[model samples]
Target: MKTCRFILSSGLMLFAAAGFSQSDSTGLPGDDFSLQGALALFKRSSSVEEFEKLLNTESSNVNNLDLNNDGQTDYVKVIDKFEGGVHAFILQVPVAENENQDIAVIELEKNGNESAHLQIIGDEDIYGEEVIVEPDGDDAGTAMMMPSSGARYDHGPAAWLTRANTIVVNVWTWPVVRFVYSPSYVVWVSPWHWTRRPVWWRPWRPVSWNVWRPRRAVYARHYVVVKQRRVVGARQVYRPMRSTSAIVRTRYSASVGRYRATRTSTTIQGKNGRKVKVTKTKVRRRR
Candidate 1:
């Protein structure tokens, strides 16, 4: 009887291990998302008012990001750069202040295959050490520390208990971004740079990952659109460029996980080639 019990216990253990492995490795049916598809999903499901409210918050124990650099923390927003289809998801965390503070931005490709990179810009003395957490057990990710009071990473893993499918890091591109320094206009004491180039970015911590229905199946799909601008009169523009004014038709976004754009209209496109009419969000920049 003891021998039989031992065999059964071992089998059960093996089964549990198998289950965990499968659960960890296996992603959702459409885990890999396209930019156009994701934008559709976000628009169809997300509440515009709720998103605006989130962006206007002055302070919150959770998701408090000072994007503009004005002593106070401003709200966060997602800027959808639509070229032909979609370009990238810009996680814009603005700070509150008179002069424009250095914005915190994380640019990501909708369907990056595999690559990894982390660059934290600001004062090495003021901000101090970085927190590098490889959460998700086997799945890979990296985050550097920034100077923030709420849910900020100082010198440890910015552990995001996120579903494996919502965000992904390509090991091949482990550290795609290079420098972390201040740009021409600097405000906050901490190090930060709003990179025009595309890089990986996770949302502010303590977000409602399961804000959507069907709790377990939800991801960070809530977002409104913002326009992205760059210095014109440049050379060899690959992707589409965003106009500060006017919305354009849907062309779909291309994934440049570890790579590299040029411009288009403001109108957004929905599923099955349905054009979703949206007003242009006038972004104000102060110096």
Candidate 2:
């Protein structure tokens, strides 16, 4: 009898080990997912049932994610069979702020053999900012963080979370301007000059003077200035300009003539159609 009992015990141990090895190889059929992979799966799958089929697993428990905060829950879960592991993730469905009841459980595997459970302790509001948490045993968790205060715009990672609550997952919100900088170096060229030059070169040569008069020159300076403007859902904001400057210079032709002019007056203008007053001062001899 003792010998028979030993044999039976040994046989059971082998069977259990084999089963565990098989489970590892197949990856729980449904519970095997990287944290990001699980969130991606949730976004793509329409329903809990669809999610399970896609993930090749079921949920041990699905409930609101508002673990403590009072709000509508926007999270769900899927579980693996052999070890009873849980994967907590969020759904993409739009919900009222603070409402936490949109979540649902897709599958449950509870056998003496393997069992897992997931619970939401608070509201999903924790997602307003990035949140990090440690995983529970074999379970994983994920959450999303909003863009920082005074963020330039709403262009960045839409969501983020960890593979397991214990594992750290990071999501970044990239600035929209990062992808696009306003066109710089605006040149105000004469329409006549632009038409005469090749289309490609027009941007480089903004102003031109008649080639016949080499002394008559035309040039432009480029500089940027900040201006205020309102954007959708935002208050007045400062925007950068690509270029700003005086485009043209006034010209004056002068013939020699004496004129009283102030020291501060640097600009010389032609007077009396025939001659221009080029100002010069003379010292008087006191006798």
Per-candidate TM-score against the hidden true structure: 0.23, 0.16
What are the per-residue Cα lDDT tens digits for candidate 2 across 107-138? 21111111121221111122211112222222
RMSD of 2: 37.9
List model 1 lDDT by residue over 1-287, tens digit each. Answer: 99999999999999997665444321211112112222222222233223333333322122333323233433334443323211233333322222222122223222222222221111111111111111122333342222233443222234332332233222222222110111231211212233321233333433222231122222223221222221111111212322110110111112111111111236788889999876432321100
lDDT for each of the candidates?
Answer: 0.27, 0.24
